[model samples]
Target chain A: MSITPFNIPIVPKLKKETIYSLARKGSRIDKRKLDQFREIKITLGAAGKAHGSALVELGHTKVLAGVKIEPGRPFSDMPDQGVLNVSAEFLPIASSEFEPGPPDENAIEVARVVDRALRESQAIDLGKLAIIPGEKVWVVWVDINVLDHDGNLFDASMLAAMAALLDAKIPQHEILEDGSVRIIGPPIEPLPVKKRVVSVTIGALGNVFLVDPSLEEEAVLDTRIMFSFDEEGNLVGMQKTGAGWLDWDKVAIAFNIARNKYTVPLRALQGAFKS
Target chain B: MSGKKPPFPLLKDGKRHDGRGPMDLRPIQMKVGILHNADGSAWVKMGRTEVIAAAYGPREPPMKAMILPDRAVIRFRYHMAPFSTDERKSPAPSRREIELSKVIREALEATILTHLFPRTVIDVFAEVIQADGGTRTAAITAASLALADAGIPMKGLIAGVAVGKVEGQLVLDIDQVEDEYGEADMPVAAIVGLRKIVLLQLNGVLKPDEFLKALSMAWEGLKRIYELERSVLGSKYKGV
Candidate 1:
């Protein structure tokens, strides 16, 4: 982590007001429709040194995911399972608003959301990662580096993380006679991916629902709900961010939109691994 | 130091290990204004060393104490990602990073007309995502491009390059292998138009005459890098 300065500037009130009015008319400042997402591009194995890596672009927002697997002790509560550690860095170079420092609240929130969605949904088969049950288990560390942030980093980062996991391969190892393990060869065996999880974020401004809000729209957003769904459309994880509240009807609309929008990201993720 | 020689011969048949003449630089690719949220951003790839730099603000200083009534302050940060190296580095800014940040700030501050924006701060964030060697110079070069892209007033762009001695032969653009085993390393940053050296750091040892030789070699490398910088900036605003 780098050093961060003390003061952070805020978005202008006039801009927020303009964004609010534009949303009311079913248009966005970026000219995006109410339920439209920006263009998405995914590149697999962007970080050649990492075991698995993916670079994702949601319009102007860019996120890189790198996965590193190492042998480590399993948690006491989960001896038969491997560990999945996900961390997100809101790199200072990404945006003017982001500062250089340790993971801030927003960074922590993004990491937790991505982590919960993948872990709770059982995207990776942890049992296959277990080498010695209680003693040694493979730990997968997913490091999400935000290169550029336009808006909607949550979805972009989640998509990259999931794709990186899919692209990951477990390194070949040998169980030694003394019960210790030795990494013998290059990375082999594609990670056991059980399901694909896609996270969709919906921003609310008054009575309007905006999909994939831009930075300006996010500034004026009253509330935001992130829904994480699996391929089967199961609600694996859900989190409500911001200070505003959402009634049941608005939540229902968000859910429906998330279900419908899951395919967009799913197609993008599949296309990345296909080549 | 123990009299341990380098594992491999750094020079053979008047060519360096990578099979280049004494003054040949590695391939360089640069892109400007790549980040959407940043006011100005640039990405540079010199061989395997990849760095991205972003510039924000001639805005109010973040801290009151940092405010300068006479001129704007340049807040520069140089960071290497945890996974940037062969071994994972801790995310914390080390003493080397802090010192590099100061040196990089001084290098760019020489060219920037800070007096034009008093009581303001120009933040330059440089991150080395992949490092083979000479990351400091690479970062500074990218940062200068980012500042220019940000529309910051400057006398001219600054170009950075390093000259090193390997196997008793002067070489341009030291890579990771040469950097570790080389006899001497000299990193220099200069104002491209002014021909003034703003940053100069010498490691290992060099004779006074050899120092002059290294400086000249660095100057030539700087000229090539400056051309690339100009071309990258030109491509950004072709009509203008």
Candidate 2:
């Protein structure tokens, strides 16, 4: 009945030393290069009942994304466009640190980051979701559930959300004589997705940087930066976390790393859609 | 009949709507240890209904009061996704879900050797990703496998099935249509090898003789499910 704060476990000193030494050798604890990612497996339509859904496993981290669309009144200011609401729940059983109850700060942050990446990059064509001028529109809700926490959740969650959106279908409807709408048929049209966005996390330890750090690596890292890129390699959003700061040079380097390797996850996501 | 015509002829020429016989269960597909983060997990599909279950623990209880001195406390959470039904459901636990969770926990607890791990809790989470009725039975079946996949000690595997009376005919494994329009529904869960029922819930109406017939039909369906569960576990843990 009570809520508790999530506590990040401390890594052993020897393991930290080993990670630092590995960084000096341009390697990682997982034996990947500085900019390499772990194996990613994605399954679309995993949530068979959702309009669109995907299960993404970035290494050991697992996240399930489900998209539901319903007819509702559009916002007063954005009457011409539909709305997108993104929420993430860290299931208590996913990890020992996560507690049961409502979404905590970490869950909210993940949801907002994924939401901003998709919204800012125009991933879904909101204008096309409009059913009427400003009175009615399809409100798309993307819910992310973290089933496992092995680190690099931001990238995994973003990929899951994107895959779910791409796999979504809009329900067929008929306008009634009273000007109300009725879903007359099953989902018939795919959601209008205009752009593809992929996020990559870069972890920094002293002067060395690494990509897709695992939970163990994250426990000892000094700082980490996440970059979201559109298909054209344009930076759409970024979030910097950890107590340490990254200089401009490091920031540019991180951006370049993301630009060059963003295709890895994007291609993986697209591959899931095709299957 | 309350002067209301039944929704379509549920049975024709001795065959049910889905071409199944009176005692034939819907096709089932099951996989164990499908999730990496959980100690044990399983995915199951029965007809059009799909459910995934994950088991965690024998670890320390999150709340001090939940710890049991003589055995591990079993906590079950059954969730039907917002999109799991024809109409979108709210992403909140409902009364139905709460009751199902309690029954599922009790059903699983009958087989799990919780006394082996004292002062701890075993968490079982079942999610109905898709529903065409009988989701609770499907979820319980999957959760049983998940607990086994988690390598928890148990006396025997548990299997579940639902039997109902539709259009005055006893049928095995009612689909969504029959669930909404049928005259009676009875879901039963039992320890597979021991043939002991741990959970049973009845709704609607049925005479004593009809109830007995439904129970026997459910037993037959559960036996087949138990075999499937064994095969799945055997194939996954062949060498170990």
Question: Model 1, residue A103: displacement in angstroms?
Answer: 0.9
lDDT of 1 by residue, A1-275 (tens): 22222243456889888887888898888898888889989999999878899999999999999999888899886787889999999999999888899876567767877886787667889988899999999999999999998889889999999999999998899999887889898898898999998878899777789888777677677667777778877665655554334443345567687778888898898888787
Tens-digit lDDT track for model 1 on B159-237?
8888888877889999888887776667777777776556655554455456557767888899999999998899889
In model 2, how large is the Cα lDDT of residue A211? 91
Docking verdict class for candidate 2: incorrect
The i-RMS of every model, in angstroms, reads: 24.9, 25.3
Model 1 chain A weakest 10-residue run by lDDT = A1-10
Q: Estimate, for each residue in B1-240, the C-alpha lDDT of model 2 and write its tens digit.
A: 111346688889999888999898899999998998999999999999999999999888887877677778788888999999998999877646755665566567667898899888888999999999889899989999999999999888888899987888989999887777676667777776876565565554455456557777888999999999999999998867
Worst 10 residues of 1 chain B by lDDT: B200-209
Candidate 2, what DockQ?
0.01
lDDT of each: 0.81, 0.81
